[model samples]
Target: MDWRLKRNCSMAPRQLLAFYLSLCILSLGIATMFWFQGARMIMTFAWIELFAVGLALWVVARHATDSESIVLRNDRLTVEVANGQQVERVEFQPAWVRVEPAHGDQSLIELSGQGRRIAVGRFVRPELRSQLAQELRHALRRWQQGAARPSPV
Candidate 1:
C-alpha cells in the first residue's frame, strides 16, 4: 500500500481548550452578577459548576491527541498509535506483514508480523472495519507482488 492512513480526533486541542475557557468565562460572568446581588448561595453553586466543567474539560483534553497513523513507504510499513501520554510505533516490511481483524469480522483490523502486533481502524466506524481490513489486505498484496518482481538485468 503506497498510502498514509491517519485517524485523528475530530476536535483539535486548541479548539477544545478555547471552548473550555470561553464557556467557563461566560458561566463565571453570570455567576459574578448573581454574587453581587446578595444571592450568596449562587456563588457556591457557581463554583461547583466551574469545578464540574473543569473536570469534564480535563477528561476531554486527555484524549484530544488520540490518533493512529499508518504509513507505507519504501518497502516499509510504519504504524504509530497515540493515546493520551503514551505512544507506540512499529515498523514492518510490507511483504512480511499480515492484515486481519483482531476479533470478529467487524472488529478492529490487526496487522501482525515479525513479533509485533498493531490494531488499527479505531477512528473508522465499526460497520466499516471489515472494509478497512479488505483494503489493507489488497494494498499489502499489491506491495508484496511488487516487491517480489525481479528487476530487469
Candidate 2:
C-alpha cells in the first residue's frame, strides 16, 4: 500500500521563545566578539549572522502553522516541520504495536510496535495527539494485515 499525506508543523510558544532567545544569544555573542576585535571583522561577522538568522526565521515561520500534522503512506511516514525537514520512509509493518499519547506535559504521540518506538509529534499540541495516534493505528493495522491500498510511489 502506498499513502501520501502532507504534514504540518507548529512549535509550542515556550519552544519558539526558547529558540528565538537562543538565536539572540548567539547573535549577541558574535557581536561581542566583534566589539572586542574592532570594526572591520565584527561588521562582517554581524552581516553573516544576520543572514543566517533571517533564513532560519523564514523557514521556521513558513512551516510553523501548517495544519497538517503527519503524512503516512505505503513506504513513508513523514513528520514535517522540524527545522523544515521531513522524516520519511518509516516502516508501517505491523509487528506487535502499541500506540499511545506520551506521558508528560508535552503533546507527543509515540508508537511502540515491538521493540521500536518513535515520537511523531513532539511539537504538536496535546489535544491533537489522540487523533494522530488513531490515524496511525488504523494505518498500521491496514498495512500489517496486507490490506493497504497499492501505491505507485
Candidate 3:
C-alpha cells in the first residue's frame, strides 16, 4: 500500500504577508500615476482601484486557504500550504512532539513539543478539524506514552 493520505489546505501567514506587500506596492504605483496626471476623474478611479486592491488581497488570502495539502506517511508528517508563488512545508516525526486538541470536540488541535504549540488545520472548519486532531492525538499519544508504535504513517 502507498500509505499516503492527502488533505487539501492553505498557505501560511508569511506567504500571505509577502503577497499582500507586493500587491500594495503595485497599487501604489497606479495611485501615484493618477496623482501626477492631476486628473479629477482619477479620484473616482482611485477609489475603484483601492477596492480592486482589497479584492485582490481577499482573493490571495482565500486562495491561500484553499490551495494547501497535508500529507501524512510513516516516516514523516508533512504539511504543505501555499501563498502566492511560495510553498511552505512542515515535517516532523511522532516521537518528536505531542498532538492535543485545543478546544472542545469541535475545535482546532494543538501540536506541541519541547515547549511550542502549533495549531494545525486553521483553514478547516472548527468542528471537523477538532475531531481529526483528536483522532490523530489519541492514536499518537498512545505510542508516545509507550503503548505501541503506530505503523509509521
Candidate 4:
C-alpha cells in the first residue's frame, strides 16, 4: 500500500488574487469618498487598514501551501514538511521506523528510528491523531514485509 498525507489548503492562488483585487477596489472606493469629503485622515487610516488586511491575507496564503507529504515506496519511507518557505525532509528504512504519538493521548505522530525523528499529523485534527498514527503503522508494516535488505538495528 502507498501512503501519502497532506494538509487541506483552504485558499488557492487564483482565489487569493481575486480576493485582493476585490478588496483593493472596495478600499479605493471608500477611500475616494472620504478623500472628497475633506477628511484627510481617512487616507492614513485606509492605508493602515490595507496594510493590515494585506498582512493577514499573506499569512493565510503562506499557510495554504504548508503541508506534510509522506510516501512509502522502494523500501524507503520519505517524509516532507512544508511550513511557509521552509521544508524539512527525512527518509528512513521502512523496517526500522517506529510510529507513535508525540504525547500521551493527544499529540502529533512521531516517527523515529536510526537515531532520527520527525513529527507528523499536525494537519489532522487533534481527535484523529491516533487514527493517523495507526494508519502509518499499518503502512510501515506492509512496506517492511516486502523488503529484502538486512534487518534493521
TM-score for each prediction? 0.84, 0.43, 0.46, 0.88
The RMSD of every model to the true structure, in order and in angstroms, is 2.9, 9.3, 8.3, 3.9
Clashes of each: 0, 4, 4, 0
- Residues 19-84, model 1: lDDT tens digits: 878987888888889989977788788789888988987888788767788777666889988878
Q: How many clashes (backbone atoms < 3 Å, residues ≥3 apart in a chain or on different chains) does model 2 have?
A: 4
**Residue 40 error for model 2, in Å?**
15
| Regions of model 4 farther than 4 Å from truth | 147-153
The most accurate candidate by lDDT is: 4
The lDDT, on a scale of 0 to 1, for candidate 1 is 0.80
* Candidate 1 Cα misplacement greater than 4 A, ranges: 1-10, 147-153
Clashes of 1: 0
Q: How well does candidate 2 match the true structure in TM-score terms?
A: 0.43
For 4-93, candidate 4 gives per-residue lDDT tens digits of: 566686668569878987988899789889999998888888888988888888888877877888888776888988888899999998
- Backbone clashes counted, model 3: 4
> In what order do the candidates fall by lDDT, top score first?
4, 1, 3, 2
The C-alpha lDDT values of all candidates are: 0.80, 0.59, 0.60, 0.82
lDDT, model 1, position 153:
80
What C-alpha lDDT, on a 0 to 100 scale, does residue 129 get in candidate 2?
60
Writing each residue's lDDT as its tens digit, candidate 2 over 43-101 gives 56776777787677766665664333345456444433333344333343354567787
